[model samples]
Target: MPPRAIICPHCGKIIAGDESACSWCGTARSHPWWRLLKPTRDTARTDWVAPALLAANVVFFAVSLILNFVSHSGSILTPGNNVLLLLGASGTIPIDRYGRIWSLVSANYLHGGVLHLLFNMLALRQIGPWVVREFGASRMFVIYTVGGVFGYWVSYVAGVPLTVGASASLCGLIGALLYFGKNRGGNYGNAVYREVSGWVMSIFIFGIIVPGVNNWGHGGGLVGGIAMGMLLGYNEKRKETPVHRALALACGVITVAVLLRALYGVFPG
Candidate 1:
């Protein structure tokens, strides 16, 4: 049989089949036979923003469940409740007849049901990473929280009472992505912009069809996202430095603290 050439799996450098070491990466030829095959896929890069955002949503949902169980407040409505919140019939409202207004921020994280939470998280998973990758995590967080609060406030002003969910925030992420794509305007940027625009259109259409979708919140979020994107440059232009990282970490910690407090309020020892 002819002698076969051995390659370093890590560096792809050629070596004698009998060689036991990779001259380039210093990786020992532990399995020469396996090295003969094509290289394995590279590990996926980590994105701090996406995972942190997902964790926040999941933690909030869990805390909401605990609140439901302990307080029996009936404020935590789930999808099984039949889109009651979507119809604007029920859910937390910032303004009540007595002129109380505190739900503006709190409503951003509340969901009407399992499906409501699922859909928002799905959108976040789809769009959150792109926003983080383009705008840096710190700016993305600001866009999410601020845009969400702003979107809800707009809905409130529009007289859409008792609205709640992360859809508005996710829409903001999409809007930001759209702005980034259009403003950046390279091959990839334009492509992303077009694709996200399609998503925005689809979402708008869906909102029209769905009985309880908050069109006002969606529009407000989109506008907010574009504004924020313009104010904060893309990740390529603005590096995610130590300060940005610190801010993101701080936001994550605050989110956790808020959920903990809510849980404690519901289930005090």
Candidate 2:
């Protein structure tokens, strides 16, 4: 005769006394026998866009350092007084003179010092993966590049001079995450939004207390990120599409082209 069956406590399923799991639903029978087994679940793995973005930032920094050395004998690149206006480092538009407006885009990859690079990259590592998972990689790239350009433009308009770094772009990523969390409208989402908002506020406060911190850039990047987030939406609104991949690729190409141009302009062999 067959053995009598018992139901699982967590998930209602019947199994024979000696069986470890339900034959119908695969629920583990939580008797002494099931207690001895390991737990497992089927979960989706996160995408690779965030790590790739971080790697790109690191590579850009390394290449910039090399170019700086070859160009001006300095270990890091700085805009020469002659080219400052052209390079968008001067923080002011030349009166009646035209230069590359695209420098706003290029400047996102440049950093002033080790601390600058460290802080920006750290922030990226912390917040970037979430953004990519929620919105996909391409949208995140758009938010980052456009947000950085907008932030730098604001600083320039405000008369802050000679700024360079990825902080503005990183700030944009934070902003996007904030918007995503808020728009989702749940305990989990609200909690995340609040936490990120606190981080943003703390950064602003620190900037106020510290000299040489560009609050304008930070504010502008945040605003840009929020705006882009509204336009692009969280993953709930759309699936990962080809548009995301294309935008990411475009941003990468633009970054590479800008670095090449900067190297050629500085070295001028």
Candidate 3:
């Protein structure tokens, strides 16, 4: 006979005798004030999307870095425009004249410079896992990919000739967090709201200070993320459903098809 399972009070999920926390809600056996400070290690370990996205960005950056060096006097500081176009940089020209709309999705994985890659990856590392834990891997991917596409499309519509980076997706994640915080409505939720609000403020300041920054993408991505979070709902309020899984699968297929188009543009043979 199977052993009797203990039901978790937090999320109402069943668990084994030795389990110390609710895998679904992340409530520990012993409540600690600082425990709510960050997601526990177990929650972090259960997620895969955040790391996979990070690695994909890194790999794409390496490709662009090498190609940039080949054409730009051995410089990895900024990839040449040709390599960026080949890898899918979003712009009015690419999207309108050539009909390279796929760049909306592919552009999320491309970065401009080493520092650009580093900063975006660092932000992803910090916030991505939290989003994955809250929304599950599939929903998180939807937010990142769809939000990014929406963000880049805004930039395209605004006539930005060329833009590339993961900032839009990262902003989406932050926007999701903002939604989570505002809706949750408690000390923990309030804390999340306050922290993410600070991030939003800082991003605005950074955009104003930095030249060539695409505020349109950032704003659109944030709005997209909020919309996704509202539509999808969080893990606490609603469990991972088939709809989320299906959306994630659709995003994956679309991303692959877009990348293939980018490759064909590069080789054409």
Q: In candidate 3, how many Å is residue 21 off?
A: 7.6
Backbone clash tally for model 2?
0
Question: Each candidate: RMSD to true structure?
Answer: 9.1, 8.3, 4.9
Predicted candidate 1 versus true structure: per-residue lDDT over 1-269, tens digit per residue: 63467655434467676666666545566754323222222111444666767776666666666655555545555522222222222223426552334344455666776778888888777677667656766878878876776787788778886677888888788888888778766544666776788898898889989898899898988888888778766665666677666765675565556555444544479
**Candidate achieving higher lDDT, 2 or 3:** 3
Compare the candidates by TM-score and give the number of the best one. 3
lDDT of 3 by residue, 12-61 (tens): 46666566766766676455434564665666677888888889889888
True-structure lDDT of candidate 1: 0.65
**Model 1: which residue pairs collide?**
78-113, 79-113, 79-114, 134-235
Q: Evaluated with lDDT, which candidate comes out highest?
A: 3
Model 1 earns a TM-score of: 0.70
Deviation (Å) of 195 in candidate 2:
1.1
The segments of candidate 3 whose C-alpha lies over 4 angstroms from its true place after superposition are: 1-37
Query: What is the full ranking by lDDT, best candidate first?
Result: 3, 2, 1
Look at candidate 1 and tell me the lDDT of residue 191.
Answer: 66
> Model 3: which residue pairs collide?
none
Off by over 4 Å in 1: 1-44, 66-92, 97-102, 241-261
